[model samples]
Target: MNDAHHRDADAPLRMTDAQHREMRNAQHRETQRAVSGFRGDIEGLRGLAVLLVLVFHAGVPAVSGGFVGVDVFFVISGFLITGLIVREVRTTGRLSLARFYARRARRLLPAAAVVLAAVAALTVAALPPIRWSGVAGDLAASALYAVNWRLADQAVDYMASEQASSPVQHFWSLAVEEQFYLVWPLVLLALVWWHRRTGWSLDRTLLAGLAIVALPSLVWSVSLTQVEPGRAYFVSTTRAWELAIGAALAIGAVRLSRLPRAAMVWAGWLGVFAIVVAALAYGSSTLFPGYAALLPTVGAALVIMAGLAGRGRNAAGTGGAAGYGRGVGRFLSVAPMRAVGALSYSLYLWHWPLLVAAEAAWGALSVVEGILVVSLSFVPAWLTYRLVESPVRRSGRLVAVPRRALLMGAACTAAGVAGAVVVHAAVPPPPQVTASAGSRPATQALAETSKRPTAKPPPQDEPTSITLDPLKAREDKGPIYRPQCHQDQPSAELQFCAYGDLGSDKVMVLAGDSHAAQWQPALAAIATRHGWRLETYTKSACGFFDVEVGVGEPAVPYPACTAWNAKLLQRLTGPDRPDLVVTSSDTNYQVVRGGSILDPQASRPAYVSGLRRSWQAVRAAGVPLVVIRNTPRVNIDVPDCLSAHPRDLAACAVPRERAMAMSTDDQIRAAEGLAGVDLVDLTDDVCPAPRCAPVIGTMIVWRDAHHITATYARSLAPRLDRAMAQAIGGRTSSTAE
Candidate 1:
């Protein structure tokens, strides 16, 4: 069979079969009318993208956003893969399931299996036994093409993971591409199938239907980029529109090829310039796949189109369009680039591990060294390409010995999973990976506490705030570690609210979860001074309903936050008639398990219901509800803070640039609803000047990784005083008790 016997005859990621036929029909049309040789140029572009990805992971400063290379890969994949489908469908009348997957298995599985096997063997030897398990588990996920989700879970979490490390991290893109191949061709093929059955132009039909998908996906990509950038990056659903850009091009290349020669050349020129500029100018800060992404993807599309146009230029009195593929096209087609592109799969496989090993050996790779490491991976890639790639691809041996290779791939994947399992099993199930770069007290402290629960000291040690007897803390009343926990309530005998107690005004009830309870001391003092009664109602991880995720979590036994909030809600709405309801929870921890995220429709409605109930309860009680926004979480554990920096002013601070960025949009949205609610945006105070200093003024803001400290709560007395005054319909006073 010709190497170009054409694989990926159908798309892989979409959910239907008819769609596969449409892709084949359209691709057949391209073949019949001369689709040109831009396909090779697209492959070249893929090489450049994979190179960017390889270098970025290799730690090249120049390619900080080199991860965007994956986005580029996606776009290129969409275009070229779609073109193949179109050609197949137009020629064969039907798409072949066996051939499509067989080719993919041959192209992708061999190198991936070899890499996994090598990594597994190397990791078992090099890594401490403690870490081998996790590395193994991630390997399994990678093998199954599900590492993206696995990595995503760890990344988007509100816990202590900054994503600076994680060896299997590079597999995310491969999984994403595989995922794309799974369904996209089906959509194209289905259109063809539908057309064969309905007699419509595959071009107009696919182009129209794909547009419908593209538009909403465009919205979702931007929305997710705003709400969850990391999730947006790894999730195939969010990334499809990017690839669809390429798919649209493959379907419409005939029209582009027919355009005036000069027009095609200019389009091609504009496209090439965009790709180059994007590569050179963009970096990490850009809100990607947002508007910033259009630059590279669309540019690649135009270049591909132009290259296609160029090939067909002189063919039919079309000089430029039919002349030759050049510029980005020609450059990509050069011997060096073509070889790189051909070996790209192997190169991508080898590069990340090599770089990771190099980093482990040398701590960090300098720009020059990073480049060298990436360059070095090619040596192995070349060997693998000739040995692993060429052999499996050329000889029918791979197919003949499919079981052996399949077993090999499975065994490697299983070993990786087993390693991860062992590592994870040794630790708690929801494994937490921490990167303590420096030997600060915080890191050491975290290392101490991260061990299986042995002895936990009292709640945060400070001037005075909350305290909980670990045994009694789990009482029917719920977690009692409030700010004024150790202190008496507001009263003349108590000399008003003490240090932690701010005050309780108009019988203000602070009701919610741990976040809601953190306000007790501040509100206590303020209420005491203002002659208002302050009551606090809280649950550890529970919210107002049984749905909200708590501070300490997995939500298995159900977070105490929801239970406590529910009780408080019941109590406040009934006899208590508390004049105010102030509550908050970590809006980020939406409990999920086993690679599945809770849908917004699932628990979100409950959250909204709770909010509405709270509002209604306050309305009935004739009280105001102060709904504080969930604080942006810090990744460090509190004990780590005390142990690491002890008292260093700038020690564990979240960089000011990052601090000012603001919390999750979901938190904002959750608070935005409600009839008589007052929002207290403390995002500023939480991350103050010079940067979100580890210690704000004199108070450490966090208790553990995500909770607030009583000291920091006290420091925000002034801000809380103001927020409360507005929270309730009354005059407020501020004084540091």
Candidate 2:
């Protein structure tokens, strides 16, 4: 009936029945070993991948590009999983989707659930109340294997970008793998079904399918990485090609198995070299999962292929390179490597949350401290591996029944989701603040002509009760925070919003970057009281200067910002120009010139020239310009500090000299001799000489490190109105009753 019986049917007639039965059993065992035997070399490769990632995350200076290790892991997973599927389909002529999923569930879900539950508890203890709801949401998404999409959406969100990293953010990689597992099998099954119906070669059909799915993803990855690198990093579509390379290797493994031992050994070491080189050469500035990802992914494929070739030689009794313990494989199959590989999955899960918790407790950890925190995670990792992962994966009952394993996986997921829901429910709502009408103290309202003011006596101790809830501070961004009012990257088209006294004949325009946008509440209130129509034109990280600006870490040329500035200047100088154009921008933008980004000190002169050029354009058009000096930055997240230290508010205050130094006031220098451009200095009103209080007159001054809260900005309306009136030659308009 089978190969073993068929081969011995005629030749073994002389042998006894018992001896014939024993020979068949021995051959069957050998066949099973060929299909599913363990590879110690692969285990060692896993150890190497995890070690690279951990060391990089722990701030090891040598492995700047160590993040490439994730690409290696992707390749390894694709090869092993694809090989298993191919062997099953080749042996049985049909794939059992249920059994495949059951095996995956038994191997992954138990460990993941334990880590999620532990992170949820850690969130309650270490993270501030402001972060609890978000972490709970992240936990639920991780359980559903959809956190990657959630993070992808957050990548483009302006406000979300500033929030603290979630402890469970590492789950994004696991989500991508699980999503692949869900779809890859169905695709293979469809190809198998077609093969059965048409008598087509299954291998060729599978290769064609893989090519169709993977090539476009590779092209898209390259294109998207250039335009939207943040979103590109987290999305599944951009990363699929890396896994496909490994799957392609699996499909060709049989043909490649006969390669010479010397060739295999060379390839094995070369692959290791490539992986190590990428780890050392790459850094946070590297654009990832694009063409750059090929180095590590192909390197991993080579290592796996070489290991397979060695095993093939051993099975054939050629004795040249009998096993993985040859060349690089020997190094990989050593005991230390195998042990780390065995615990790699649990270690990966446990390390990230501990690192995040440590950073949250103490501002930022040194390299040694980070390494110590990661090292401490081994205890929980080992416990989870021993108590949960091993027992469930080896459970005889679950293995005997696929349905029971699937049920257990479902139960584990539900428990994780349920725990997240409880944490979400337990988080208290943000406290409410009651607003009251009040007048500003005379000394606090510094005018445009005022001299440099002396340090004021320390304000009475921080109010017992804050007027705005610290939890609600982040959402206190002004009316112009919407997409229609403030444009993001990738769009060069001009977009503006009109508010306050829309029917008034007098016109005023507010224009610049987010620092300019933050003043909208006060300016809008002033416009409403004085009966002037106000139009706002602002873009995130894009200033209203005639300078080539570079943005983001390891800054790249911002062409969109250039285009937006051109369009905005054209509108301001056109026939429908407003009577007054008020502008402000963050002073920290790097200048791009001759294809290079200049350092901060080098960028100052370019900024001054650019500001003068913009101001000259408005003046030539017969429109007056008002430049609000950029506000002082706290250089620390005010809301997070407030939430962490509510009672001892002094701990959140930034020193006066340090805070004021953040405002370089290049605008002041540009406007020195420029006619009809009024410069309004509001630094004294925001920060007195001695120190800048986090809470001023019961109002939270800053919503984040830089942007002022809309509530505080609104309270400054009366002072801003007085300053603007004096700057614009005291135009007459009735104030609102």
Among the numbered candidates, top lDDT falls to: 2
- How high is the CA lDDT of each candidate model? 0.60, 0.81
**Model 1, residue 506: C-alpha shift (Å):** 15
lDDT of 1 by residue, 277-371 (tens): 77667765455666778888888778777666634333422322113444556566656666667888888888877776666546447878888
Reference-based TM-score, model 1: 0.58
Assess candidate 1 and give its lDDT: 0.60
**Model 2: pairs clashing at backbone N, Cα or C within 3 Å:** 65-282
Tens digit of per-residue lDDT, candidate 2, span 1-737: 68889778856675767687678545533443352467777889998999898898899999998888788889888888887888788767678888999999999999999999888888888877777888999999999999999998887675677778899998999898999899998998898888878877777888888999899999998887765677788899998888888888777666566578688888999999999999999886777768888898889988887776744434633212225555687788878888888898999999999998899889878999989987888898889899999999999999999999999999989988987997798776654433233633232342222346433332312443344467788789988987588887667889889888999989899999989999999989988887888999998888899999886654667889999999999999998999889999888889999978788899999989998999999999999999999999888878887776655556777777787778776878999999999998888777653556777667778898888999888877776787877888886342432
Query: How many backbone overlaps does candidate 1 show?
Result: 81
Stretches of candidate 2 exceeding 4 Å from the true structure: 1-36, 197-199, 316-322, 430-463, 593-604, 731-737
